[model samples]
Target: MGNEDFKQDKLIPIAQRSFASYEEMYRIVDFLNKTLKEKYNIMFGLTKNNKDGSMVITIYEF
Candidate 1:
């Protein structure tokens, strides 16, 4: 099978805060996951968390 070429748009920083709690993080992550899946058909997994407790989202490309 031939390979499919894909191009990604520039990444814009997106931040969401709710009551300064970790529960807000889950909502943001879930939103990001669904958006990426619907828009790019890609699945991302959590790679790491910073010392300050912020998370890093990883988009895996096939």
Candidate 2:
């Protein structure tokens, strides 16, 4: 692969919320939000139950 591909891979395309319970999910969400803001200066749009009862988190680079 090329350097660009490697970099892209580092930016996760899909992330599923942890198997932890509701409370844990909130903690994870908050942690992820803060971490992204601090490290990449990015904000993610978190989606819970996009379909059925699944949770998805997506972070787009600005």
Candidate 3:
């Protein structure tokens, strides 16, 4: 639909975690995303904190 129909509240962060390496964090996020995206309408995100080298995982409700 349109941007007006988009609800910011629906896209919320439900959980978060920090990891030492991207590979390990990515694996878990990727698996959860693949398994939960359709049935649960949930998604996972990965990013690096600018101040630190650790990888960050954010679980979201879609």
Top candidate on TM-score is 3
Off by over 4 Å in 1: 1-23, 47-54
Give the 10-residue window scoring lowest on summed lDDT in candidate 1. 12-21
Q: Please list all clashing residue pairs in model 1, or write none if there are none.
A: none
How far does residue 49 in candidate 2 sit from its true spot (Å)? 2.3
lDDT of 2: 0.56
What TM-score fits each model? 0.37, 0.45, 0.67
lDDT of each: 0.51, 0.56, 0.78
Task: Report how far residue 39 has shifted in candidate 2, in Å.
Answer: 3.2
- Clash number for candidate 1: 0
Q: Write the per-residue lDDT of candidate 3 for residues 1-62, one digit (tens) a residue.
A: 65424633477899998877665777887898889877887788899877878888888886
Q: Arrange candidates by TM-score, highest first: which order? A: 3, 2, 1
After the best TM-score superposition of candidate 1, give how far the Cα of residue 50 lies from its true spot, in angstroms: 7.9
Better of 2 and 3 by lDDT: 3
State the displacement of the C-alpha of residue 25, model 2, in Å, after optimal TM-score superposition.
Answer: 1.7
